[model samples]
Target: MTFNAEPFTYRIAKSGDVHISREGRLVVMVRGNAAAKLAAALGNGDESDQQLLARATGNYKRGNERLAGSKRR
Candidate 1:
């Protein structure tokens, strides 16, 4: 018996959206609450995965800051 897990990949789109790529092709678009949730999890959660997690953390932090900035105006 053999088992293999699918590869995971994602990128931030031009409109500040998140996307997951599969099999060398763009597959899904992650936006709104879904994107925010993923960002929160990837950031706040204590995980060892550095690269993607760091990106997510940065995104979440920046988004919150932007939201706050807009509110002040």
Candidate 2:
């Protein structure tokens, strides 16, 4: 099965707060030093960055999976 490559997005506010969203819904707001660190890590914009965002929002996998062919048609 296919999954979204970039499911999470982020915004940096003027106040240096990091706002992370999933599908247009705000999931977390990071501030201060933590926000700075997150911003730097996200700069790469790679697969690992996506995974970091997922973990930050506690959205990582929880053992629920099924092969594409297993889906009832």
Candidate 3:
């Protein structure tokens, strides 16, 4: 028999919190340390499958000094 996996979806609320849901029901709204962890992971991980996650929670540091716009002094 073939198997199918359930799907999970998530979004970031206007209050800067992350909400995770399965089957259209909210399972959890991650905040505090949990939200922080998710944000950190998004910054470091490949997120082709998690476009919403990045849009909602990723806070990445700029990698290049020249492009970041600051004097080297």
Candidate 4:
């Protein structure tokens, strides 16, 4: 079996932490707790309230990166 290379769309914006869509429609908007975890997976520094917020809410986007076991800082 084969899967589509681009099955889903991922957007990271300051206005809406993270926006996920399939077939060009907003499927889910992750904020609060969920967003925090996703943001960390994208690449976040240390675990702290302020750091999480910065990662969760900002124009910064992690679109070009992939989830990895570890990344060089």
Expressed as tens digits, the lDDT of each residue in 1-73 for candidate 2 is: 2246788888999998989898999999988998888887887866777777777776466556555348676
Residue 52 lDDT in model 3? 40
Worst 10 residues of 3 by lDDT: 53-62
Candidate 2 all-Cα RMSD: 4.9
Distance from true location, Cα of 47 in model 2, Å? 0.9
* Per-residue lDDT over 1-73 for candidate 3, one digit per residue giving the tens place of the 0 to 100 score: 1114424467666666778676788766778777766655543323442544433433422346566677656
lDDT of 1 at 51: 42
Candidate 1 residue 51 Cα shift, in angstroms, is 16
TM-score of 1: 0.43
Candidate 4: minimum summed lDDT over ten consecutive residues — where? 45-54
How do these models rank on lDDT, best leading?
2, 3, 4, 1
Q: What TM-score against the true fold does each predicted structure earn? A: 0.43, 0.71, 0.44, 0.45
lDDT of 2 at 55: 71
Better structure of 3 and 4 per lDDT: 3
What value does the lDDT take at residue 45 in candidate 4? 29
Give the best candidate by TM-score: 2
Residue-by-residue lDDT tens digits, candidate 1, 1-73:
1114333356666666777665667656678887866655553323333344335434423445557647563
- Candidate 4 per-residue lDDT, tens place, 9-34, comes to 55777854767665688666778778
